[model samples]
Target chain A: MTIHQTPSRLVTIADVAREAGVGESTVSRVLRGQGSFSKRAGERVLEAADRLGYVPNRLAGSLAGNADSAGSQLVGVVIPSLTNIVFPDLLRGLTGALDGAGFQSVVGVSDYDPDREEALVAGLLSWRPAALVLTGLEHTELTVTRLRAAGIRIVEMIDTDGPGLDIAVGFSNRAVGHASARHLIGRGYRRIAYVGHDLGRDLRAAKRLAGFEAALAESGLALHARELVGDRSSAASGRAALEALMARVPDTDAVYFSNDDMALGGYFACLGRGWAVPERLALFGCHALDITEAMPQPLSTMRTPRLAIGRAAAEALSAGSPPGTIDLGFELSEGATA
Target chain B: MTIHQTPSRLVTIADVAREAGVGESTVSRVLRGQGSFSKRAGERVLEAADRLGYVPNRLAGSLAGNADSAGSQLVGVVIPSLTNIVFPDLLRGLTGALDGAGFQSVVGVSDYDPDREEALVAGLLSWRPAALVLTGLEHTELTVTRLRAAGIRIVEMIDTDGPGLDIAVGFSNRAVGHASARHLIGRGYRRIAYVGHDLGRDLRAAKRLAGFEAALAESGLALHARELVGDRSSAASGRAALEALMARVPDTDAVYFSNDDMALGGYFACLGRGWAVPERLALFGCHALDITEAMPQPLSTMRTPRLAIGRAAAEALSAGSPPGTIDLGFELSEGATA
Candidate 1:
């Protein structure tokens, strides 16, 4: 087991300098190719460095090692949360392409906070990754500056409505919301309510709500009630929010959840309270998650192409394609719920 | 318009060397705090380096960084999949406790492969993470050696039967499997079949299957048929596996799935086929996921204390406690399924 293993200590400029019998500064200058040095001296230093197995530590300079490394190959992707199956499914597609091309991936989570996202972006950028793949375009001003200035490729995924930084790979949240509202309105459900998490922070959700309300307005009807929860969206929060929404607005005929997970929770709440779904309270949701389809009567939801989006983003990066938006499209599933 | 600007050209190590009127190697030595250097020289080098805002490139000599940063109130956790929701729920508790104690976390995904996990651990070790919090302890020999020589702390999660590398935090997988089998057997369900994915790779699932088979043997009932899929346990895979299993073994009265995701899939399959669950054929699964309980007929399964396990592991690391095992018990939910 005890093979002749080298000490694992880094071969620094000092080692090269010592071996070459020259000033350490000389080695640094020669390595950087900045200052003038005698060719013989440079040759001696290089030979000594090669013999000592000296590898330059690029960490000393932020940009020294990152640029021109086979292409913009290492992409730093920042998502809101991995707990959501959609994100991972997206990654599965993204990695399938990125891996084959020898591109490495570094990931960061913002926990759905714009401020945390900005900080995470800063940390990720320190690596000088080839490209930045962020969840949504709604980032802090500081994040925008750093990302723009970094001058690497930028791709904002999962939502495309407003102006993009460089590239956008997703459908319009506003369009999705409008479609959901139109679909519900067309079904003769007048007294409609909206149950969602913090939309102010999640601009994508806000856009969807705007589109939904716009469709409702066109139909000469307004939202019966809207309940917005603070912080991350989840089943428990969805259930609690729905309970509060229904309790406060008893006359609402239909409820549209922000996402399927929340709607699933709302469904459970209905089951717990001994209320018949669809007949008593029609429920609609987005993201046709497997469980949503698998539930006893199935859940009526809009299926977003999450994995396709991810795969497309990776493909764009791979091909070094010009920055633009791509709409993968969505589908509305009419299940037993609505 | 430039309230703050990041220049196109970064401040590199050579700038610090020239500013300090010292060799570049002297600046590196001071920043790294490695190899003997005069204190006066180091102070000058460090002062110049600080002014220049140099963050070292970790890619070069990353291993040394791991060796230096070990046991510094930072834990690196590598899990297989966050989509499982089990891992995130687990991380929620672990981070909650550790965050309070001034400990930070860095995470990596191994994608349920021993080889990927080995690379991730090596990467994490280079950062000198305080404690290595991994999903399971079934590691490659090289991974074991690197971990053993890591000289910090270790915590293996989610199963306890295997040999603990350092500290193990989980319940016995075998017990859960046996209990599930016994519960089904007690219900007079013979001609039972098991359906799961990648038992050969998923050590935990394999252990459960072994235990389930043992219990079946004790009750004079063996698996009527077993089907294994080659992938991580997923809803779609589970449903497909179940359909295949059912088609082959039409005489089977009950089926056991690897986890709730796959079980939900199987349940969905039953729904699609118009087979009355628990009447025409019983169903059983593990990990009492919240969605599973929301179904009309609650999932009859065991709720592993994933969060509790994570919390206990973090607590052990923060308290600087010695290596040992922590068993957070599992809850068996007796529903109409089996």
Candidate 2:
């Protein structure tokens, strides 16, 4: 009934050779599917390998200078949470682009924890991937050190506000925040408030908020109220935060959310409470998700080039491009909500 | 401004030893952080390794029988697509469970293409992972052959209508369809239509549709009308398909969508058209996504144990349990939408 017994000892090519009644050289050629071998010998070798569960050592093959093999075909990618649709969109673009170039991605999710990211980096690096693609510019000191030591192509994607360790492809978060604030202010929304998830871990959100506050200050105004949820951003949290914010600051006219998921929740809160959007309250969000666009009243948000950034990251790695920032700018949609 | 010239030659331990002015064994000891080495020797080795970009070959390490290292700690996963929230939810559960057991997931997205899945399987096997986790029970012949030959723990997740290659963890998709039909029928609704995406590639969705049709036939009724989109399921597609269905079959009293994404779109379409839900026309969907639950009127749908399936799959692999199907079961929610 045992599904699989963890092999007590690793299966070897020699074992397959012995079982197939072939020489080790013939067994190796057949298993690797390289060089010439008789059709009968190939069948016997495969059957023996299958029976013994002898997995071919691709690492050994790579070490033998097989440039087109497993090691060179892998690109290790590390990202934050998958709950946010943005990360998945990024992955779609990356995988789509990487697939075309005959490479596969090995992914790790860090859940916004620096220590987890550092460990994941070490683990992926040990595989000797052709390149490493990371979510953002920030990382633990150890992560930075290890990436530097790995000597692989390093691509820090979805942020370009600072210097990258290697290649950086994304729009500036500060600029996105600044534009959101300006759009709201241009429409004469003075009593603007904020609803966001924990900013301590999501540094990008923090950066965006900073830009928003700076723009507001430039206009001689400040946030009337704010609700900072201690958990990750979600529609449920956004709904609760909006309800709480409304109770504390009833006169707040406009609300800027950290991202579209939060804004969708805020929109739902207004719908449930019978608050007229843009008339009684205005809402703004970042990362123009498809759901947001399809809302009864499309959410007013900045459409960051998420998929494009992912594609660019992959393309840069495949082409072996120079290391620098590629700023694919954002677009502001003045949706009916705001 | 060359960021990195794809290392013309891989730096080896001997190279590090030469640069560090130390023995290769000492460099290896320092790099692996095993055995004993003087502090000065360790420092020199690290500096040299960093300067030379000497990546450790974990494949060789595993071949050398480092049981706790890379090969054993990896579990390769292949899923259909990431665009669906369901897949991400499954991954969240998987990574959350596997992380605790000191295992990391290497993921591949097959886009519901059996050929792509086959290639992905071969690619992942080269890494010599401890286990292989695949979605659904269906696979190409070569994929099945390779998985069986790989001799690793295999966990087929999120569908359990058929036999698994090894461990299977999920509810029956057919059962979900049947229950959904029964629920709608119990509500005394008839003249139901269906809106779905391409079923040719999504075998599980096809299974559910088959069950739904069977249940309908048992009740002496069949789909009053149906709309099958050639593209993948999405809210936008759902919305568009709903409009098309209503236009084509105005008398249809209820609609069953493939999944929550499509249903959400239908909901938005209804709102846009001022149609009262469940009164004018009822709606139902599969996979109870959070967005569906958080809607103004929650969606009536079947909630498959997606996360539980993922957790169970990981647990089975880690625990090395018996080879059998584990029906985690599903839940049906009759919300206001229906």
Candidate 3:
């Protein structure tokens, strides 16, 4: 059965009025409840409208036809994924601020795809939003062009290491990585392995890994072995990667995962194999997630200020004053695992 | 200094023609490239259009003027949260199917808030969507009334125990909870505690917890202790709750968390306090998330069919099928912890 059908000819108030043998003004008034109509005339117009399946145009609310031109009414946010709690925390701050200003924010997920980011930017700009809030300073050449041409405020979130396309709100991922590595080295872990997902997709993770390796290199100790997964990092993948790394490099005393998910996997793998954490093998991660803290052993990790980043992004965008950087720093949560 | 000003009025084709010193038909021809116009006239029309900031109306596109009528080209989806991987997985399926049908899906987050869901439904219905897909069977009295009156196809997802307000497509959360409890009990875990957040808000989590209690009660084993947080369940809250529960109920050998986040928290709490998981305490959760599998010892839990639920809901709405239930079962993954 046909769920819906399109009329052969467009039905309008004029058509309804003509069919009901009334003026267009009369039909419009009756439909909008703006003016009175004779009961007989109203019934005839209503019957004609029902027969034609005519729906009144509310394109003009109290705001009239001005709806489409309001640039500040729509805020466009482009992020990598919502699966990670960090993004949600960031949005909590952004939405809290923007909605209060009567601005409705729409989101697009690129899944760490630069081409997709470019495409999303083009689509979001078509709405002519007041601001574009994106994750990271890294962008494809096309994305940069469209964002610039869109002539809207841009806020790059979750990293403050490099020159931003516009305003930047986040911590230095490199610093986070360096701090993590330094913390591990300070704990007297000489040999360490790295387990992570595709750094190509998550540039922030790559920066963190680079800084981690740099700190280790300073002590004449490089990564013992790095086990990588070419997919989105999760607890399951982290566990599998850690298991594979242990079998390949059993001498490694500690392992630093790309994120908490991977670290949790490494932790579970240790539990399954009856390996004593910190004694036989140490495990460390980024993102001081609540789960990490709750694990039988709290995960040794860094807590990026996700909510702060989001709030700052909205504040910076709304200020419409200047383009600069705001470093929302990270905190190290030294749990029992490391 | 106004960051947000009331939007300016729209300039119609008539205004553009008036500014360009041309007839409306001639301006339309020049703008749409549908009919012939002099080069001078075309240039004049272009300049006037640019200066006036006139945008072509898409309301007259392939599916125009259906905004207030039934059979609108819109599909509305309401989900709990994307921060969890579940909703995104569901969207992957829904988008893959609906995008091909020229039906644009607009999403709203209820945040498990029934009042918010009710408001969103009213807003979405104003667009007169062809179909409305919402999460869960449980809805507010006002929500049920408005939806019933909306005269649109409705599909409630991720539940199957109760009667559908329309179409229902999901598995039984209670069954998943029961299975998890039975699995832990079979492993000789007699002293089991529960770690959860506001069950009143998240009905699915509440159902799981209820089923778990029912199963445990059958074995003459009631929950030893429960750490209940009157907020959304988070990993950090879960970790804290587990720690608190362990302190109060030292004899508790296992814990059934409301979901994976709580379970992960419980796992971390054990880690922080130097408790041996599975040996001293067993941790079980639901949603057999990817992170759970990645941890050193995989988390023993059930994996809900989130993608299937989403796909089924979209398909049912699209097909205009009668209201019924679709039971996409959950999976029990047994890891070393349980």
Best by DockQ: 2
lDDT of 3 by residue, A1-338 (tens): 23433334346679999999999989977776677889988889889987765654332221233344443355777878666666766776786576556454556667788987886676555445668899999999868755664556889999888999889999999989899999999999988889999999899999999989999888898988899999787777888888899899899999999998788778878877999988999999998876676566678999888877877788887777498889889898988889
Q: Give the alpha carbon lDDT tens digit for every residue of B52-85 in model 3.
A: 6564433332133344445455577787765655
lDDT of each: 0.78, 0.87, 0.77
Per-prediction tally of clashes? 4, 0, 32
DockQ for all candidate structures vs. native: 0.20, 0.36, 0.23
What lDDT score is found at residue B276 in candidate 2? 93
Ten contiguous residues with the weakest lDDT in model 3 chain A: A57-66
Worst 10 residues of 2 chain B by lDDT: B63-72
CAPRI grade, predicted model 3: acceptable
In model 2, the Cα lDDT at residue B300 comes to 98
Cα TM-score of candidate 1: 0.75
What are the runs in model 2 whose C-alpha is more than 4 Å off? A1-56, A66-72, B1-56, B66-72
Indicate whether candidate 1 or candidate 2 has the larger DockQ: 2
- Give RMSD to native, each candidate: 7.4, 5.2, 7.8
In what order do the candidates fall by DockQ, top score first? 2, 3, 1
User: Model 3 chain B, TM?
Assistant: 0.81
Better of 1 and 2 by TM-score: 2
Better of 1 and 3 by TM-score: 3
